[model samples]
Target: MNRVTAWLPDRIDRRVRVVAWLSFLAQTIIIATGGAVRLTGSGLGCPTWPLCTEGSLVTTPEMGIHGMIEFGNRLMTGVVGIVAVLVVLSIWRIRRERRDLWTLAVVVVLGIVAQAIVGGITVWTGLNPFIVGFHYVASLVLVCVTAAYLVRLDAVPGPRELAVPSWYAGLTHATTAVLAVSIVFGVLTTASGPHSGDADAGRTGYNAELLEHVHAWPGYALFVLTLVLLVGASRLRLPVRRWVVVLLLVEVVQIAVGLYQARNGLPPLAVGVHMVLAALTAATMTVLVLKLKRPTATAAPAGDAAVAASAR
Candidate 1:
């Protein structure tokens, strides 16, 4: 079994881990629900900033189920945000000189704030496709950061310094590119797609057919690139290869969801799945890249079996 992280007190570490895991899960759910809000043409479900239909948190019954669903998502985001804060505080209390842990916790808090702002911008801009797309991307990035932090805490002990080879470094760069392109296409798909609420309420002025065309081509490209990355990773020996494999699988799953979304009218379930997969893909890639750095060990001279055996 993998050793438990030493970054927390024994009495509290289990609880902290649970909170961290739940925070990650909750973030995934929020991303998925956000996709549903877009797919169902319900972006304007609330119909007012910080309020649903010029009413309190709970308003008139006529606001309908969509309003409740979207608001529920927001509520969950708040819950996840609180968990993130608690995780940070617990880390600080348990570990001495855990600068990495502290840094990530701060990042988690910042991501929550950024997500909230982007959400407000989406609403304020009346669901402008560009800003809406950005909002979704931000959520994925935030999730990626949170997941990377978690993985670092869970990784096996190794040199404190990065010790990856140049080839692995190249793979990391390529994977990052793949991640960025996939996210862009995902955003494009969401921007051109329908929103929650009335059919015409949140429509973007861009030609839906043209946007679909744009989104589809990149989707194919991203899928291809992701496959290439997996193949390329096979040629390099890297500590993060397992995570890279996980990343590729996540991308493949996302590709399936994208295809399903295109065939069907962006069903709530499919969109939610797409959103979660996208975030997972991003998180996996982030962990892979963060593991990369110049090799700290000098390469052994060729045919030095005796020395190698001794070192081993």
Candidate 2:
């Protein structure tokens, strides 16, 4: 065990950074592939949980393209699991010294397992819209955690202090709240729209049009707030400046795709892009939140993160 521990790096190295990035990238890829499964109407292509179908561990020739798409997404989960495991092992030696990285790695693994079960439930429940929405929210959360790990990877091992003004921090947090609200409403909007994973899966019995407008309200609010943040960040030269800019750009593309899909008969391709962008938006926001604080290098007390600016 000592030899094994010795083999692991005591600090973040290229390998550690690679694995950290892979963890986040894999999470994002899975979301995109999951979007493919839904947009392609293959949510039930497997037709059962823990198995592709009765007495078969994979999709059969008889299942056709839908099965392949759904099964492909499932296979991607295995890829995600493998990457997550690598993350845990890669940081095993440093777990004691870097509890934040260790904890986030464990969370990624647990989140993947939870996602698999929730995915099965989506199948069992006939793709219940609410459950599906929750599943999506759960995945976004995993993306956020992985993104946070990447941020914390470079943090100094000590307590943190807000680098921005108190009011700026409060506005930043409120923007995060608006972002969450936007996502919730967007999920609801999709739940009642034409795309519910499967044709026969039906919808959440709400007004799709109304929910679209409701979703846009928060989206617009988030955009305005982010604009304000970007202006302040540019002037203050805050650490979070670049990432808030990223968040704003993502929102722009997201809103564009959303509008295009809404007006263009809800094209599956556009919808899939929108979904992936949403995950990216959430991930970017996670980075922004982490940047609100800087490591107090000389603090008597310990903390979770370190100097993360260059790591991004």
Candidate 3:
């Protein structure tokens, strides 16, 4: 144990920060690649789970562009998995001293495994719209978790200070709820729209136009709530004002993308950009929520702190 501790960094510093950012970027990149799979109608390129095909483990010359695209996206998952493992291993020595970071790192590794299973199920179900929607939501949830981990890293080795009022915390919670609803409705809209990943893929069988309007309502509510939150944060001189502004800007850009896509017939490029922004918005909201509350202290038993201090 002493040797392991000596091998790893004793403190959370530049190396840890770089790994955290890499983990976040890996998640973001996979979202974009996943979007490519759907936008290009390549969801079933491999046509088999745990393998590219019945006898092949990767794309072949006969599989065509669709096959290659889907297989490529699958390969990207390996990259994410590698990063997840690195993040977990990097924090092993400090696990007792910083359980929050260690726990999140482990969660990220497990989440990637679960995501792989979900991806396989999506393929087995023949690209069911509901299943695919759930898969996207799972990615967003992972993004939120990773973002929280990143923000919390900055407050380590000390007691966290509360940065916002009780009411502001409640407001942040409300904003998160509304944002979740909007994302669900947005997924529903896509499920009912023309993008079914493949020509034979099943859709939700609802009126796309109606779903679009429903999604827009929550988005509008989120916009108003964020605007109010921004004003309140500014008036109260909370540290989260910058994050609020960022969230508002992301919301405006997403709204514009949705409107333009609706008018322009849901072009692949527009939808792709919208998907990226959605991930960004989720990350921003996560950081904002984490920043509003006090940082969690390492809950050591009676003599653990003294032991840790001596070890350092």
Candidate 4:
């Protein structure tokens, strides 16, 4: 049989790369628009799901600006879904040959579906803080997945081996764990804060001040851990140095934004920036962690091999 990729885009081909970038970009933008939705008290702009409201698929005039914002977000979701579906279909030629790429492609599309379901849950619960927090966390998870897919796109398909010393690997894992803790606390802190997506949404009973410190401690700790990773990467001359540096830069800005909002009564604009930076931080960290390994070696991709044999 002929090579399928002769007519279809390969894993790292221009079309696939563009679609992947769109997937990543869409995930990032949704977070920003989503923050706008919550901060502007338009979470319920449509006031119902699957139909926006009972028997109505679109926002009504009564919903006003809130309706528009929410409808815009829903439209964005459609965009994300279409892009995600494209990613999966684009790699059909290599789906069996390049499990790494196709698997991620599949996961991302499925994640978009799962996220849509979670979004519905957020509405059904009347923006319950815990459910809302879970919803944000789920979106962050998808961001991480999309970030990972983007990073892997730069590498060849093959088995991978640890490319660093054992201790260094341990440090990276620890760093990731610390980052997780920081993010979890940050979510809890937000749940306890004034921004609850809607005026009727209830907040957690925790004291915002105390939870803020709880969140800050882990964040500060994460920064320190990242510094250690950066230093180690520098001393060892590891290939991951650039990724670590990028992760550090994101952390710096994130922390500055966090501090500004903590003192300024958590203005909606600053808070939205903080949310965006947090996603960036998570995404960059994901890239760094992936950089820890390299393909043990490279071989001809299945499509290329097939084409060469066919020519012979």
Please, what is the whole-model Cα lDDT of each candidate in the order they appear?
0.68, 0.89, 0.87, 0.86
> For residues 111-190, what per-residue lDDT tens digits would candidate 3 score against the true structure?
99999999999999999999999989888888888888898675534555567888889989999999999999999999
lDDT of 2 by residue, 136-235 (tens): 8899999999999998886776677898999999999999999999999998988899888898997989999999899999999999999999999999
TM-scores of all models? 0.79, 0.94, 0.92, 0.93
Candidate 1 residue pairs that clash: 41-195, 41-196, 41-197, 42-195, 42-196, 42-197, 43-196
- The true-versus-predicted C-alpha distance at residue 234 of model 2, in Å, is 2.3
Tens digits of per-residue lDDT for model 1, 1-312: 124345444333566678777777777778877877776666777777667666476545686777776776677778878988877866765344445666777888888988887887787777777887788788887787778767656433223455566665775676578568757865665666665334654545666656666666655665676666566656655566676677767767787887887789877677778778778877777777776643224322321332343244
- How many clashes does the backbone of model 4 have? 0
Model 4 misses residue 169 by how many Å? 0.9
- Please give the distance, in angstroms, between residue 65's alpha carbon in candidate 1 and its true position after superposition: 1.1
Q: Which wins on TM-score, candidate 2 or candidate 4?
A: 2
Candidate 2, clashing residue pairs? 155-305, 155-306, 155-307, 156-306, 156-307
Q: Write the per-residue lDDT of candidate 4 for residues 1-312, one digit (tens) a residue.
A: 356547676445778788888999998899888888899999999888988889789988888999999889988999989999888877777688768878888888888888888889889888899988887887888889999998877665666778788898889889888888988889999999999989999999999899999999989988999899889999999999999999999999999999999999999999999988988899998898888887664543653454454345
Quote the positional error of residue 181 for candidate 1 in Å.
Answer: 1.7
Best by lDDT: 2
User: What is the TM-score (0 to 1) of candidate 4?
Assistant: 0.93
Which candidate do you rate higher for TM-score, 3 or 4?
Answer: 4
Q: Is candidate 1 or 3 superior in TM-score?
A: 3
